[model samples]
Target chain A: MTKTSAGKPFPWHILFFLGPGLLIYFSVSVYPLLDTLRLSFFHESSDGSLAFAGLANFTKLLFDVVWSEPFWNATWNNLVFFFIHMLVQNPIGLLLAVLLSSPKLRLSGTYRTLIFMPTMLSVVIIGFVWQLLLSPLWGITENFMWNLGLEDYFDAWLGKESSALVTLAFISVWQFVGIPMMLIYAALLSIPDELSDASVVDGANPWQAFFYIKLPLILPTIGMVSILTFVANFNAFELVYTIKGALAGPNYSTDIMGTLFYRTFFGFQLQEGSLTMGAAVATLMFLVILLGVALYLFFFQRRIKRFQL
Target chain B: MKNTQMQKATKTIATLAAGFALASTSFSAFSADKLVIESWRAEDTKIWSDIIIPAFNKSNPDIEVVFAPVPTSSYDSALNAKLKAGTAGDLITCRPFDVSLSLYNKGNLTSLNDLPGLASFSDVARSAWITDDGKNTFCLPMASVIHGYIYNKEIFKELKLEVPKTESDFFKVLATIKSESRYTPLVMGTADQWEAATMGYQNFGPNYWKGEQGRKNVISGQEKLSDSQYVKTFEHLAKWAPYMGRSYQSQKYSDSQNLFTLGRGAIYPAGSWEINGFNAQADFEFGAFYPPVPEGQDTCYISDHTDIAMGLNANSKNKKSAKVFLNWMASSEFAELYSNQLPGFFSLSKHAIDLKDPVAQEFLSWRGQCKQTIRNSYQILSRGEPNLENVLWNTSVGVLNGTMTPKEAADKTQASLVNWYKPQQ
Candidate 1:
């Protein structure tokens, strides 16, 4: 009656609140991403001049023997690294989460805190710590294994080309398994007790109840965890860098996209930095990540729907 | 009463304004003379801050020196970022060889060819810091690092062995040590990729590659790394691998040094920079020797490349003060102080202080006796390629692991070089 419903002006206060955040987001994240994408098209001349080279950098990265060899090796290694996490890390995490979520489990709070402690620490620090523990020179692990009468099983896992990447992946997984554990734990806790009771009352055993009632509910979280693992694994650098160095040594067996990106971008030893090529690598990494996320959303994520509990 | 209050307030305000104006003027005048140097060696922070700057101030009291120490791992990238952003220090510690050349070509460095200090350095010392054209001196050559093996004197004495001068003799010594089983024959921390290349191949590469002449040949496309000489270097490295102890690949750079200092190993291949650390840490006496050459070669070629060189930032507002610092750095007094502070860094200054440490003195004796002091292969290799250090080191790793033959390793390295150089041709 007083025209109050039709007369309210646009919320300038909301714009004011969002403006600074949007500006920061654009500058810090979006702008740099776009700029990197743009830089991938150019090449740095010997005299330090930048000239447009279009897709030449990309082409060279994929086709040229020198660049392509390392590129493919890193790509394949990165995928292997991601798969290791998927196969080993996630299952261990899910088990720990399930066990911790049990009603009969004592000291669950302390266990959760203790288990998550590694994730709280820096990855570089963890990598170094593991390196020392596993070092053949110091014989710390060897001594422990000797005490256990398993000395013959001890090997320089970090040194072997076949074992280095997997060993590093395990180290990474050990440090980060806590993340998925907490995530899955939260998802499990959100499941109502009544649902479990309902399944049990219907003559389902504990295992059957868990399988039919709880597993279906936690599927969505597992999907999310999978996506997160994919992203983190592909983007990882520090662990390999700290343990294996820039060359990702033992003949570059442990090299991942992040280290390759770093080597190309900053140069190592005798190689000069090539900004354009580095940008191209970074752009590819971005596209790979995007493709992964899109596939998750359209395929796996869509199939796993969240149900109200 | 209001008028009197107003007068009093205005007087107080004027006094405060005058005080602030004077304070700011003096501050600007003081800050204007300050010079900042960005150095990669964090270990030198104390020497620079506590002694060097104070000593420099004695000569030029008006100028202040600020030491900005960056860790070696990220120094080049950090410096590059600073230079690109126009925020680089007045004086910059240039990384040796290609990194310095790259910076100079980018016009980030100022030429110091006209500096009077340039004349004092010997031709060999001056050559380490000059441009490819040999006309422009982009940085002031400070000290040259000698690369060789640092051996436990006690172990050598106890084992009844002398410093081996020939390759066969070296192998025989290693064999004796291995047979004794009391210590590792050679302590190599190949887990760190640079160590294998730095202490192993690069140190020995010159002996076979033929020093400056080999460099010229490679650069001129007349020779490749796969050539018999370089291939033999890898083969020799492979032969030496068994003596490096089981799980040598898990040994870090520090681990090798630790093993050497603790008398766990007979020989540790390292550079001159290890002298101070070894002296401080080792309970046993240690001596340095060049890596052995072939059976007939009389002299072992040591890597005598410039260790740390100082360059003036082209965009620096305090270039005059920076040049003063560089001039002081090039002086005999400065060299004496530097050598005394960090022994074993052989100063390029004409009046370098005689190193008093027995180990350093031993290294100096080699420098005097050696027929040729060649640049390390890492220093001489082309920067246009994938790092030769990485290629050589990776290939060396393959040899060590028995995954690839020495010939294959050499061929792979040559292929990398050809891949890089062929495009340019």
Candidate 2:
């Protein structure tokens, strides 16, 4: 009667309940992550054998002229890719969400579905469709412009080095706008109608009410969307690879971190592949994403919680 | 009751295990001596399964040859992984140069020097799969593709232009076609980048580089990319921009193909591999001409690039049947069948086979008329970083796009070579 609960028989069911989940998590997720970290520490030697070389791989990736040039170029392109998503994609999505969420809006469901359609389609198909439409060889875009009397404005946007990356970024944004739109739309719908309606009774205009009331309520959703965009943009590879190829050409203008990682790891046609180098690049990508998520958690995420409805 | 259920489960498991053992024995017995040939040429699956394997089987009924192909683009990586895992095919299809050489060095490929049928192929054909010392040939050379322009015969007749033999004559023809205004003068593009190098540079640059002489010189550091001949090659390639189709900067390989096939273009800078596709698609009659030589050059060279070859896998279980199949691949019968079936891919063997495809025959005729050599960068030079082939592709694209002057292009190419290649360094 006096025995403490801690001295009682241990709960064997606890281990039983968690066994499968822990086992799978350790094998699939934790094992690969730790293994990648281990592999990154090793470097390929002259004889094609991988030896434990401490930080040699990282140093070569960051400082070796041949390796560093493409690495930095890709990192910079990835930043631009993310920035385009932030500046163009998120705002347009927000605007569409607000418009769709208006009370008694006609065909709001149809508009929402139509806008969200591109996100569900495969990136490769979207890239090809956009490439074909913009192609001067097909003259589809040029012909459409001709009918509208704006034919003079059409240019080979994808072909030019100056415009290739930006064009790709915009195409990517077009395909993914639905993601933010749906998220924000759902967030806006969750805001009780009475909240905005009360602001309307206070004699504030629709835009003013949106800014003062509904916007702040959706700030947390927007924060999540931004972080999601950051991760997706940096991880992007397929669209550019499908369109411009592995070289990311017109002088590697469209080259991004993912493509560089691919070319380094799998080796382009003439360049022999090195698995260690590819693993090192992959480790760097993981760190970049980790650092980004950490920053959001420590800074933006905390600020976001204060505005949560 | 519990003991009886466990006994029943054990009985079922034992029965299933026995059944599987029986099935596997019968399966292996039915398909004895099966050999799998792994290749990158998935498009040629029909030809291999329908024609080539059957002929071999007709003579040797005991052996089964399975044609297994993966997509061309992923072949190298897939093959490497499979080889490592000991799951690759018995007969491995080899790419022309460094790839197979590496395989030999890695002991993944067995030396084929002792294979009897190799004598029919010349030194140049075998050169692709040979060791650096020229002692061991690892792969049997299967075929080569000759680099040249496939032209619309109707368009040439319409413009009253003869096939241009020299660079100046070629330009005069381009000018005439341009002035005519109905058709594109040159159907080529920079979007894919390789066409600029392969079709534009290597297509016309052979005559300038002097083929094997210039190629070997570059490898040995006897010559440099900035040399007069190399620079001149870029100059001719750069000039091609003006003659190319509209929006040629972005025009893709498929677009160029459609333009030429639709009879909208006059001359297609082409590899002879396109003979079959053009024959099937083009409504108008067409023919090919070797890359026009520059002014005052009496001798001509063509990039008779050795493309496809086959090698014995070191780890193959069915090596006996695989060797038999390889020997048949080298025979005159296989050569004739392969050449006739795949028109553009000329058999690398010295056997004089009759070819029916008019365009292919025209290409084959160049073998007797011109000195034949492979692409310069395929060998030792491309083994290092800033890979010469990749560099050539971009620089050639830059030149075509007017982003780099011929001198700039030449300098850039040489700079990359000097960075890593010990001979150039």
Candidate 3:
């Protein structure tokens, strides 16, 4: 083996295969991330040019009243946003996946597609659709509530300060639940059918088989989906932007990290955007995402066994 | 076969790469007179290309001008990057006040004080593009959108209401409409927030604060936002809460526009820009009224806010042709055409334009009648954190939504201002 290794040249084919993709990734993704991290350490000086100001940008972002208030608000909002997704989106996705993977389910393909249709649609279109349906002036939602004899309970959910963020979170979940559903469904399908059959033959019911066998098998996938949802929720910007605008108004009730980062990066209305401040926000977002991912990979992944099915 | 396929794939990619490299080398060869104007009015792309550019070509046939507009939302940052890269256009469309001022301060814009026909604009018309000391004007003022209430003539006629002349009468009309009519009394929303501040607060607040004097006083720290006039303005906004249709807290700007144009609304607190769209959409006749003055106040003020202008890019190579185009923009012929083409956007040039659109003419007539003021939070007040304009948008929405009192709204805005603004500090 040593003689063969010494005789053979290095694997040129592997380099040839990986070179383009790696080069593209480095240029587009990796470089921008590093550059943004570098930018967080610099600031706009008096002459309107970038100057190195080591940690001043991060310090100002975390401690300055004007900056810190919004930063903390957005960070807190983003946590709530993720929690809502983990609580609502994942459970629903898992339930849907389980039901679809059940025996004798008719039109399962159609059901899957119908449930996943919103995920395939543009967020701008969905936001517009939801905004119209919920608008107080539009009255379609109100009229529906009135017809259902729930008119007294009806309120403009999107417009109310108390409900706006929750409403937006639900909208995002509605649009993206299919992703987790699809992942979980594939995991469910990949589990060996004979294992469930063997359990059933031993007088175990379908529910018992699912709980003991199928559930354990899909735990790793569930963990992966949770991490993905966490990252996506923290990075979410478009739906909020489409509906609430950069201000995320009704007194910024729905101002998430994404919108905050955007506003800091690209000044909205009268607020002049600061590149350094934006980079600092981005760096914080990166750290939060990284911490979440690290916790999941180190703790959750290790704890959850990937059963060889 | 697989090995041969790989070889073919590599060759194809190499060929494509070479093609792309060649294609990206130069955008196009252009003549010396080819001048590009960078603007944020992407919505006006058609108007610029079809109407404005064509007209300019008729006068100066040798010059080629392109109306290159990015989306309005990203204009400032895009302009900053382009200017830094030394790749911006010959002409730049100036946003009102601080945005353009900063651009000029950064040496991205050149002073157009010597541009011919600039002398024709009144001080108020030139106010938005001029520097604070009132010595240098970097841009030739293009258009100003005046604020007022665009009311349904049919609703007024049906409700037996005359055009309101004072604050009491305005409320009285709203009450009459609320009691007798199915039509919404005030068609504006807090959801988008800007409408409440722009069409509601700025429309009505100017008279309370006494226009330019009050705006200037607030800026120089002679007056505070929490002062009586400003609180009184918020109080007036608080009063508007009831008159606004049900669920206005959730109503968006587009929703209000749609509601009004659908004839479900009696009044739309408006900027002149809405005139063109309203005219297109509303089947019924509509007329505009300036914000009714408070009972004791005598002198009326209107937010004839200068909204758009054109400036010379500092690094532009073809200065002569660009200035000629700008000169034309400030001319009587251009003013008439511009005012006629876009009815609500009244030209700022001094030439008395024979406006073709009667509604626009009605709005234009207010220039002679009322003292002009821009939005209060613009100019220098919004340069810092907790931007005063955005603050007003929030506070104004809060007041209208009944979540914040007049005093709270005023204090909130004032606190944000004092936190950073040195003058206010």
Candidate 4:
């Protein structure tokens, strides 16, 4: 629109438009992240002063028995948590998206709204709701099992060290599945009607059409969904904190990086708050999430080609 | 004639203005002595807003008190940040031992030695607030919480079970309760990990470890928790595990409390802080008793720990007014009112307040009978060490779940302490 701008000096309006947003982004997001990284290199002295410790905090987190044990435990639990979401949540979300995207489906909008309802509620509220439903003293879940003639199978899964993490992961999956469903459904809706008709004309059945045509087209969206899930699963804290508390009880079985970071930052029970160690934990979390996003971008995104439509 | 009238009017206006300024100055002076107190007990807003503040105002009407309450979970961190920033309240509520020590060491709290009310506190209460050098006191000890088993008196009477005095008798009582189809022997809310360590292990440990001397030995590294004395505590805990049932792990603190209040459980092991909540909620009458020791042991020790303490902030501008409030808080009148208001909490002062609550009276009856009282291990352990509460909770859960023996659990806890232990410089 302004050919004269091509011949003019450097544009001022461009910066004028972008300045406020960039400034806000730097102050709120980038600055704090960098500051947290800087703080991770320090340690809190007994006198309540900050002293430079280089990589000592990281070394302790990775090697020292007291710190490393819980660190590794949380890291492992987080991986299991992420894997469960991948194995269970995304697939179910995909199935629901496929069903909801069907032509002439009755009450399709209503079903979509109902399915997405949980995602709209706060994670802490969802955590407490599930906690109440699963509570043994209340016997709600047990009574439901009794009605279904599966009373013997009912156990306090949320309390056992072996099952606590998995139970929490499933709860997270239940609340967040709607997100992937909506994203995939939007991607499915973007497909052209002519393309599906052409696939059918080529003797492809509905299943084959979905597999060869629709699935391939939505691979890019799925890749995006995978990375989103990776970031979210790694950063999760509220649900675990709400239910298992800061200790992530039953011998820290439900402990994840988020809860560990919170405990290290705030101090729980008898532990004194160590801001430097908390920053170190947070820095490690950032590096992990960054590495995951980098891997997804470099490898997964490169393999999945986006269709023109 | 006009000039004379103008002069009279000017004089009258000046007199009125002077009177108004004097009244405003007096008003400012009267309201100037405002004090702020911050605490973690948000639920106790009524106690402060209704009774304590009103009573304090009666004595010091010129001083206005503002109560700032934070949720317990995040209170320590919030207070620590505020203290570091030199913006905390004039009077601050602090956790008993380590947290108080840390704040005192950092010079965030003022010395309370000069307060005349310091004379009223007992040696034990004074000892909890005194520094290691014994030259200064940092806070006024407000109340001591006693931990024990709160059992349904109705259930015990219905079953014809005598109040247990020995470990064998306690187990027999559990067995008798287990024989009943309707009642659970014990209800524990281990979901909140601190409960296992605080209510279960700490309450039971002193009985076997022989109280203060044993704790001092552990602190001095003269003995380890893996030793027979401490291992027996874990063993006793494990012995009581089966009675908690299969679903015990999932039971939250609130759930366990509900079960006990609803008459579904015979016994709920908790602290004196729960007394008010239980009394208000329970339909049936309940009572508390100290956890039993081994049969040969004649004395059982109660875990008596300072529940809450208040200190004058070093940064407070209204130090004189805050001192007046603290003095009142430590007075005999405050003690009587405190015991009446929060019925189960024992007053730490020399003045005796006749406790009306039967549960409070029962706990008091154990005072002379026990050999000695010991604070919770986490309270006595050195600050900056990896949390013993978390370590004990993990090991205790392992012992209860049959994943580890008492010896193994004890050894693991010892190992954790050793890993995090640093010699005092």
Candidate 5:
């Protein structure tokens, strides 16, 4: 290591600190991902052997009606799921974060903790609890609807094909909206008070100061929220599995890639699970995620300048 | 940057060394005297721990028996990972297909011909348990579980309806239940693909279509699913669809069961295994009957030779004790205890015990009167085409949802099965 200007040896201690974590990150996350990608190119033999099957899985997924239809359905549903999160969750989170971050706000910590409580619980518990709450026979949802004077509109939304995906998406959004709220709240907190005061001194109202001064600075955080939402939505499994189950029912209207991968990989009822097909599905998911991340990194992320307060 | 790269290299090497050390140590540790058995059944765990282990420990006290209980939902993936790692317990309980052809081809299971108590099982159970070749006998036929529709006798009586012994009579009662009784006429949930099979296809569909010889005929090219009877089953299913629960295609299994158990629905078609659940609940009482056959069909109820069976591990170190356990499983003693525990569910063993549930007793009395027992079509098709069961179930859901016509559904399933079986040919 080179000597510093002070005649001390260069600070190599940071490397020693980061080395273990970096190794673990690569081995546990990065390596398995690459390995799964590699395995997708191969098919298993009749005698428990494997052979290189380049482009076969992809081609089959596209051309073969049997595979293509279900795969596309899952992919489309996953997109719908992600879109719902973006539309419903992010805006709501932003509003909550903004309201809670108000300087004059009272009991902010308690509100923050309580609002985030659902996110702290496991996805499995949330699923079953919601299932019971929504069951028509149970009448909890119906009771709530009656209270709202909208009892007629309260069908078992979880059971209808047209509504199941949206219902589940909203449930998921309800659970995770806290993450975005907290993140944006922290970003808002970091913004110097001087900047807002200056904007107010220039004859700006509270709303104008927020829209003109604070909003542009927090674009990076909102972008981050969007990217995180995208990832979580695409990778979602437990909620759907716990509630709708592996079949993703109501004619598979709620089926996403996660449930599809599970059903294909494990083989249900009579369909024998095929490992090669499962690997192929995984590879597809990896590609979709990688592509999404790449687009964000190259386009949206680079466009958003992180303003220093 | 240079210092960081050097440090990263060292860390990687250290991790590799540590992993290697752990692997070698665990390798030796695993070779020691221990046998692990994994099963999805929680009830079985208690039996193994309380009853069977003591009997096993009596003979082989040195070898420890470890139990791994897996949840039913995730058992497939959990078992697969364990199997791939070659650490899936010394023995694992499996459904028929998993234990039979799947494990056989994977070479993960061993034949159990040398084990004791191979001769005592009923021939039907024996034939269903073993591979077609005599070389592999992975499981001992444990018990048989019958499945069909369960209706509320009290409700039927209140409606002034006799047990619907024919198709038209069944529909008339369902319409009455829907219109007059302020309850769902039928509780059918196809959300889980298996649920629909339990209701329409597995027991009722095949028998109505091709009767007892359907599988053999389909195998020999003597029958096709597009035949008239197959269409009739779909037509009848469609006719009754309106009376089924709202959005029956999307209803989860438990939700549908809840609806029926809570008295929201008048009829529930489910597996006979649920008799235990109904029996346990004091607030409700229900009776089961096969779905009524079409006119002149002569009342054939769907049946299967294989029920829940247990087999000894071929790799088990304590072979003698494992046999004793299996022998105990097949014995009248085991059947008696199990029947006492779950009143309505049937066992292969000839030991007749008094059933606790009156509804179950009544159902059993009608078994001979109907004189029809149709084997589960999916179970039969599972022998040759691995994908057949899923295709059939998925297609049945589609048909029930009006997504696919009965003929189209049948064709799709047939084509898929043909493709799947092509490799075997």
Candidate 6:
């Protein structure tokens, strides 16, 4: 039908179909990114003017000790946060998915639903709930520990600089692990049962069957999960904002790029907000994410061949 | 067919005519008699629906009154946004003693210099609310908020301790309290960042004497943070760290307040404004005192009057009604109603009632003797730096955690200040 329309030398139908989506994508997504990129090249003036600064903004962000140190600290902290999610969260989610997928398992649907429930809530709500649960004065956590005869180990994890970042990271993982579980579970279910049956008939155990038969089929999904986690972790803001606040205190042990971006752009107490500096940070963040995504797509993804099981 | 077309045309004309008439009437209705006010105070929906709106409605029988209360945290940014959007309300309430100066300089606010009932307020309150140039009554102090330590009298009685009269007494009491009860002796919350700096203003009176002008001189750039008094103030702040809870950095403002009220802690050092929250306790009531400034210093408290002053939006279409409502708000009757109904509040006007809470009233009485010091800590005055409040907050946390020395923290703070401000210059 489209070829016939093209033969008629008028692509009016295609334009009509694509017009709304194109308009929305360009307006909401592309325009803002381009605008932010353009803004990173300029410096803001005191009398509410903007001047072109070329690489000056980037140089300030990198070489200027004050900005650079905090920026790098936030960046490194963000990496640690992302590392925790990938190392701990994804594996746990994958294992849970495997168990839930077992043929002998009962109430798997219930387990999946209950496990995924936390992910459905907003990040801010989850953040505050965790903060309250960990608060020492409330003693709910300590009480639980007391019941378990481990009260000595109980402390305000969120209040200590040593533990705050890890606690927050773990909380984030607890909320978001369901994402990987659902995605991997879907991919696992798509594998033909006959392949697993063949593996079992060949004297392979359940674990072996999963590794050799089903695992190969779900590699694509794992890659997808990694990329999704990369984007979400980098773009994260709400959880930290709601819990640790914009300052990301405990001597800024929990400070991340998102909070840094907000503080830089909006300026807290003595600092005035600078849009140009904010833009520079944003541009740099975008480049980091883009490079990561590109690496995943071009190298890691292509190597992990999907089996047509 | 012709007759039917003629009938359709007639119907269309009638509809358009009706629409035009409705639009014109609505416009005229909007133009005539409307009073709109914007505030940063959280309007308890029940209270507004029952009390305030109806009272205003009764006073201005023919006019309609619209009340909008924005969240306090986002008030400045939101107000600026509204100003940019050209839809700011006729009357806006803000902490005029602080922000009105810059706002006035920008010509975003209107002056209320000639408004009646100016003579009824305390001179201190009047001076605080008026512009420095003396031509603009940019704000009027609604009430004077006196703040100090809110200690549980029951706890002090149990410990057999007297009220601390000096810095050494303060530490001794904390140590005694901690020994008597294994709970945290002094709970200072630094999570909100602003809460951590509450001690900054409390130290203002002491800093004033030591430096001869305090934060005012520092803000004016006549003195630096390295000055002896400033260093001493930072030292005093460091001393309190030992007494604070282990997780003071992580404890939220509300959390620490809750701990004190629940009898888990001995003292809650906070603003007099918290009287409203503290009054909810039926089992234990708090007592107030101006904690001694230092080892040799006399008791001095930092204080500000309870004030919500109305300013007209430069962009308002209904300026006349706005000014009228502001005048009405500043009236004795309005202040009395607000003070009486809103617990922990006392009017700055001559008509202020004697609140029943002895602790709150004690602070109020002490206001006469206490030296009025300006709020400084770089937030209020530093034009270009980001909030150093968090740095101060973290430093206090570090001191409590035994990770930083007071001198080290002070130098770091001074460096941070230079890093943030010097670049702008």
Residue B306 in model 4: lDDT = 70
**Candidate 4, clashing residue pairs?**
none
Q: Residue A46 lDDT in model 2?
A: 39
lDDT of 6 at A244: 78
List where candidate 1 sits over 4 angstroms from the true fold: A1-6, B1-30, B376-380, B422-425
Worst 10 residues of 3 chain B by lDDT: B23-32
Q: Model 6, range B208-232, lDDT digits (tens) per residue? A: 3442255555555566555565556
What does the lDDT come to for candidate 1? 0.85
lDDT of each: 0.85, 0.89, 0.89, 0.85, 0.73, 0.72
Estimate, for each residue in A100-200, the C-alpha lDDT of model 2 and write its tens digit: 99877999999999999999999889988998999998859999999999989888889888889999999999999999999999999999877877888
Candidate 5, RMSD to the unseen true structure: 5.3
User: How many Å off is the CA of B402 in candidate 4?
Assistant: 2.3
CAPRI tier of model 2: medium
lDDT of 4 by residue, A1-309 (tens): 487767788888999999999999999999999999999999887667888999999999998877888888999999999999999999999999999999978899999999899999998899889988988767599899999999998888998888999999999999999999999999999999999999999999999999999999998888888899999999999999888888887888899999999989878756787889999999999999999899888888887777798
**TM-score for all predictions?**
0.93, 0.94, 0.94, 0.92, 0.87, 0.87
i-RMSD per candidate, Å: 1.7, 2.0, 1.9, 1.8, 3.3, 3.3
3 or 6: which has the higher TM-score? 3
DockQ of each: 0.53, 0.54, 0.65, 0.44, 0.28, 0.36
Candidate 2 chain A: worst 10 consecutive residues by lDDT?
A300-309
Give candidate 1's iRMS in Å, 1 decimal: 1.7
What's every prediction's RMSD, in angstroms?
4.2, 2.6, 3.1, 7.0, 5.3, 4.4
Clash pairs, model 2 backbone? none
Q: What lDDT tens digits, residue by residue, belong to model 3 across residues A204-244? A: 98789889888999988999899999999999999998999
Q: Pick the candidate with the highest DockQ.
A: 3
Model 2, position B314: C-alpha lDDT score: 94
Query: Candidate 6: how large is its RMSD?
Result: 4.4
